[model samples]
Target: MPIAPAYDWVAHHAMVSPDRSAWADIDSTGDGAGLACNWREADERVGRSAAMLRDDFGVGRGDRVVMFSMNRVEFIEVQFACARLGAVFVPVNWRLTVHELDYIVSDAAATVLCADPEFGDTAAELTQRTNVPHLVVFSGAGSHPEGSVDYDDALAAAANRIDADPALLPVMPELTHDDPLTIMYTSGTTGRPKGAIITHGMSFWNSINLAELSDLGRSMVNFCFLPLFHTGGLNCYTNPAAYFGGSTLIMRTFDPGEALDLINDPERGITHFLGVPANYLFMGQHEKFATTDFSGVVTTAIGGAPSALPLLQMWEKVGCPLIQAFGMTETSPMVTSISKEMAVRKAGSAGLPGMNTAIRIVGEDGNDVAPGEIGELWCKGPNITPGYWNNPEATADAITNGWLHTGDAAQMDEDGYMYIVDRWKDMYISGGENVYPSEVESALFDLAGIADVAVIGLPDEKWGEVGQAVIVKSPDAAGSVLDETAILNFCRERLARFKVPQSVRFIDELPRNATGKILKRELRG
Candidate 1:
């Protein structure tokens, strides 16, 4: 396949629709608004920002430029800038501890570290330990070391040196679609964090894949509240809008009422967005949710986890249908998605594969399973990541014959829609019977008095392992009435004997990662 030459899509959109809005940064805390740049201005900002990175930071081709900042419009600027320079942009989770980030910075050997003002001290400390060559305060420059670059001053200087409207990487014409666009690190729950190399090809394919499934076009206004550090944030709708000439409403961070405010506002014209189950749960439970009119909103996707029936009904009542999607970081995070029409008709289903993507449910024997049988889900497409960065061994283990082993247990129904059961690794055998915790959790959701629940396999005296239920009781549940015996009996009536939990442990809350996925590893103790 012939690869397209190196370039940025922002430039093309700017030329085609110069005056159209490309990005709108909404603070959501105060007036609930910020910078709203049209295509022409956004393109100029990206060009000058790229120049600043190249000239001031000495950033170059193949170098890693790691950014540690909250959800701001500058993320788009820096990412596109890196692409313009033939460099790789790396966005780290702001919620991650300094020690956790140190591992990623050192692993990537990041040349230039850019961060928001609040994290300047953390960035400085990282620089000290990793001894990174350069550091730049991404947005506002606070009391940091003198050598650090301020994002605004650097861009102004770059504008003075470069053309008013500049051409990006005219000399590096050989840069192609397969070149590294970003190195997104996976949530290192199981082991060490592996940097998934997201290529320019995957970015384009994801946009095409999303467009194929939904009405994401020039007029699309994507409301982005998810963290840009994750694939769901960047590739989900943010990057797709950039590719299709649509504007993105970038929020500083997630705030339920604040989100409702923007979604309800007619002027913002927020059309499409993506969120996890927890996001919808909160938004639905919000006092303002009762009045949330889905008139301006077209499609808001759900991922990270499956949506419960009540959660699905909550949005359905308000006229917004939750399009449940399934994917991970390595696949550019888009594998399958259900349509709004099938939102409840096929509730809990991940729906169909994208036009450019293919999926297979392979059983333990490495053969395709019959329509309703659960098996490991494997994905292949232009959207799939090539492999992990600097970890060839890990890469080789992840991909086989151009197919990414998604490690997700799923099944395809007769209608061709896929149902993601649970993580393949999360499945445990009880007395030789496979037990998917998600299945148990879903069943438990139907039971009253249970606020939240997670099931894990524990060592057993006779059976190889037995299911253990870690639960959070609803505040209204009468005391002692919802004890271990009652819960076990409730499961016994619903689940197979082997699937029922042998023991129950109640907790105030369930531990979750940034994306709201229950931390099973943390629960194992």
Candidate 2:
């Protein structure tokens, strides 16, 4: 069944549950704020946004519409608008350098770049370099780039045009499973980022997989603080909210303290949330963590990196257990998720695959590994991405037959639950023994006054490779005399001799990418 003639998710919600709240924006000030819209408003906004893209920006079906922005309501609006207009949307990470973003914009061949005002200069530069026909800036505090269209003004004009005649709304294109819904660039280790083509079917199936797994409902209120460009933010729960006629509170900028206050506010009624471990880690370290209420939050999920067991345990003790999940950008970002019930019981597990998805750990021979044996993880399902955009060689290497070769080392227990060991590239052989850095990091997180930590392999004379601990001291340990010997002793108490980091270096913070994963390459460099 086509989305238009039989089952348009957004249109169905507009008709059946028009008054249901669909979205809100959480501004940066630690004060509760910004736009709120219901399903009816959402449909109209999507229509108007699509109208603006087509009539004002000259975007057409199959054209790439690129967005470079932080977390905001406008990002999702443009996403829906592109889908409605039958254009393949690209959400470029706002944290990328101009050069990196330029590469993505050129590769995507975007006709119009809808961006946040904060990135006005970059957008203008991209327009000049890429020859983009239009640069539309979202309405905000920052200066609008020269000659760029104001998003709000364009939307108003689109509304007027639609009022003059509703026919101005985009005519539904005959889309198929092959039609791309989005192109998300994944920053894989050791190479330039590759744009993964997430198809319409993948999005739809992911929404279904996540909704059923997370117990999503029409009344649920999702707190979306992750970058809208990341699949974790886009598909995890935000898209599921739209799919189920639910609501979401968007974050213009993520601040741990503000997030804590908002999550504790009973009036806002936040039901679900998701974040990378760093997001949760900072929140747990905040002064507000001791008292901020978690009774209102139905569930919160953690992914993007392996979380420290103690971090998960701390959240569990606070009555808000963070559900550990496993996924990547190419998997529509919801390959598997642990339920709240299993969150504590299976504290270190990534849990089972999504109901509609299938994942397996395979040995070097490309056959399934026995339970408890570590192997490269592979996944296949409707929710998985078709392949990378434009790069057929990379696509051919990544996806074998119908399966995506996820370069993650993982193991499965007898119960069928999965445990992600570590990235194959990240796992270093210490004296001929494989040492997973996450395990060492997890043990080290149990230490107080340690805000953040990352373990990377360093070449050694005696051993082929050895672990190096990069520590970010919390405020309590700001000037404390915690020397390398003490840290090594602490790890020696918890880990095997081979797993302990050979060196310890304290720093103010770890170098984390936009999605919250530690940038080990930078550390190695």
Candidate 3:
């Protein structure tokens, strides 16, 4: 017997636990009201949405549907609907400008566009510019734009039209694990973002990897506030929890104070939590930070980048351990993660590789490096992506001999713990010596009065290139604001003289993409 598509799990869940909570969506518009849906409702809702995509929009197998929305029930429904029909769902970063979105939609040859009304101007402009045949608009009270279909109306109509109809009973196509599920566009820190093809198997394997490592179960209640366009938000804990019959609280936008309040609520019994390093930092700085009860949180995971030791120490006060993970959009977003059991001991490390994942740190010769030596990280696993969409050259460069070149410079210790030094492109040569900015930044992360910092190489007349430290100071820091001298002294104590930043520049905050990873390229400018 063949395995059914992942979407069929929703129906299975509905049959087993029809009234069990599936997801609770928090309003993003600053209002506190929420909408809760059970497994049965979710199954029917996705089925209706799928019917609309098939009957109304003419979406079929292998078609591409682009979604431009924040984290909402509609976004989840659309993704399932697309999967039901064997169509690929392309989730674009709503934070992206119209120009960036245009390239992805056009490149994917999307047949239909589904967007939230919050991005009305962008959606209207995109439809006019691209070959997208149908536009479905969702969210808010008033009618949808002039020519677009209102999301609520569309699903309700489809439900009413197809209710109790035997012909429309099997709206979903026969799909296998190898079928493409989504086209997640990378955050293009270097250039134009490429759409990474995510298969059903990759997603399923990642869920399995996480469930085994994190001990996720039906009793687990996770929270999601990250943007859905990235794998960190979609595949990380959200989909994994949903896949394992757990409940998830989805927030449309992240608010540090609001998140603190939610976590502190005793009734929610929020067990599993995941956030980028910056999120933990912000929440640690919130006014309620001192009073928030974190005793209920089982596993607090951090990804997107290696976390600062100081941030981890802060969470330690709340009786929570911050688990650092390392991955990219290409690897279904999970290659290595610090397990809950080893989180404290391997505090700063990316921890061990996933159960089915193999990680290698290869030097310039494309051979595995000795322990403690930095090299490009290569991953081979069932969870790894097949390749990028419509870009064979990029795909060829990314995945070779069934191994996905992660493009991240990493070092592994004798105990098999991995450390992500920096991105290959982000590593720069200063004074004829290799300088990984993350190494420098990690040393500065524990400094007094310093909130955040990013190091970049600047062209130098004598050294070819030199390091520049961009700093963000803690708001309530006492004594005095740190200067170049203080920063230089701090790094001088912790890092090599050549590795120390040549100059220091202070800023209010670091610029980050939607997923909260520092945008070092923007800082370099």
Q: Count the backbone clashes (under 3 Å) in each candidate.
A: 0, 0, 0
lDDT of 3 by residue, 393-465 (tens): 8888888798998778889999999998766767665433446677677768888788998889887644546
Superposition error at 1 for model 2 (Å): 11
The pairs that clash in candidate 2 are: none
**Candidate 2 local lDDT, 1-525, one digit each (tens):** 544231356767889999988888867532223767788898898889999998877788889999888877778878888888789899987765665566778889899998878779878998888888899988776758779998889899999999999788775577776688899986544335689998888887888888765779898999998878888888879988888888999987678999999998999999998887768877889999999999888888888666677889999998888888888789998888888888878878999999989998989998999999999999999888888998898888889888998888999999998998766557665543446677678778888778899889887644557899999888887567677888899888766577789999877778888999889988987
Write down the TM-score for model 3: 0.81
**Model 1 worst lDDT window (10 residues):** 164-173
Those runs of model 3 whose alpha carbons end farther than 4 Å from true positions after fitting are: 1-7, 28-33, 141-143, 164-166, 188-190, 427-525
Worst 10 residues of 2 by lDDT: 1-10
lDDT of every model, 2 decimals = 0.82, 0.82, 0.81
The deviation in Å at residue 248 for candidate 1 is: 0.7
Which residue runs does candidate 2 get wrong by more than 4 Å?
A: 1-7, 28-33, 426-525
Which pairs clash in the backbone of model 1?
A: none
Question: Residue 204 of candidate 1: its Cα lDDT?
Answer: 89
